[model samples]
Each structure stands twice: as C-alpha cells, then as structure tokens.
Target: MSLQALWNQFLADPGRILNDLALFFTLAGAWLLLATRRREQRATARLVPQNEAQAVALDESTARMNRFFYRFGYGCLMLALLVSWYSTRL
Candidate 1:
C-alpha cells in the first residue's frame, strides 16, 4: 500500500490510537513513580544508622517494595499488550 493509504487506514481507527497513547502514558507514569520511590528510599536509608534494627526493617521494606513494583509493573505491561492486540483486531 502507498503511504497515503497507510495514513488513511491509521486515521480510520481513532480508538486504537487513543488507547495506545493512554498505555504509553500509564507506563511512563509507572516508571516515574518507581524511580521516585527508589530515590526516596536510598536517601532515607542513608539517614538510618547501620547498627539499628530500624535499618534492617527499612532494608526489608525496600526489598518488598521493589518486588511488588516489579510484579505490578509487569502486570500493567501485560494488560497494555492485551489491550493493544485487541484494539488492532477490532
């Protein structure tokens, strides 16, 4: 197909374009939030003394948060992929 025909075909489905944009924004937001949380944790960890129980607790919490973030982030990605696939098939 010609470039013009491809452009026309893309424009014919405004919904797919919008869904892709929304998914992009969602992934971006998730990444930003994860980065911010990691930075905050690092700063906070520096303030706590190495010998304290609180430091240990903080380390555990950080690990848990990291794991949760990865799991949740991947779930969102899978959902976005499903949505994109479904949109294209519609």
Candidate 2:
C-alpha cells in the first residue's frame, strides 16, 4: 500500500495506534536493556586497556544507555495509559 493509504488506515483506528506504540516500546525497551547487559558482560571480560580514555568512554556509554532505555520504557507505558483515557472519553 502507499504511504498515504497506510496513514489513513491508522487514523481510522486510533486505539490500534496506541496499542501498537505500547507493543513497540515494550519490545524496544527490553531489547535495549538486554543489549546493555551483554555489553557490560563483554566489557568486564576484556582485559584492562592501556588507555584510561577507554574506561571513561565505557562509563559514559553505560549511563547514557540506561537513561535512554528507562525513559523510552516509561514514555511508551504512558502512551498506553493515554490510549485508555482517550477510549473512555470516546
């Protein structure tokens, strides 16, 4: 289908959009968390690097990753809540 057709389809069913958003975020958040965990494991398994810069970068990466996934997870959940609220109003 064309892009416009797809957009029109989604608009026709507002609840479906919210549900799809919730599902997408749930999956994306879980994957981000898992990937971060794996990266942490691999980081520890590696021998200490001669450069101090690498350690600093790793710490920064972990913090950023955690924040992003946490926000993403919560935001999507909020969207699901919004959907429910909207349904009641309808």
Backbone collision count in every prediction?
0, 0
lDDT of 1 at 72: 73
RMSD list, candidates in order: 7.2, 5.2
Best by lDDT: 1
How much lDDT does each candidate structure score? 0.69, 0.67
- Residue 36, candidate 2: Cα error in Å is 0.4
TM-score of 2: 0.53
> Per-residue CA lDDT of candidate 1, range 1-90, in tens?
999886787789866775876588568658956885787678567766655565444457766876676777767667677767667776
Model 2 lDDT on a 0 to 1 scale = 0.67
Residue 48 of model 1, lDDT score = 69
Model 1 C-alpha lDDT versus the unseen true structure: 0.69
Clashing pairs in 1: none
lDDT of 2 at 23: 69
Q: Estimate, for each residue in 11-81, the C-alpha lDDT of model 2 and write its tens digit.
A: 89867765676667666656766776777668765635556556534577676876786677566656656
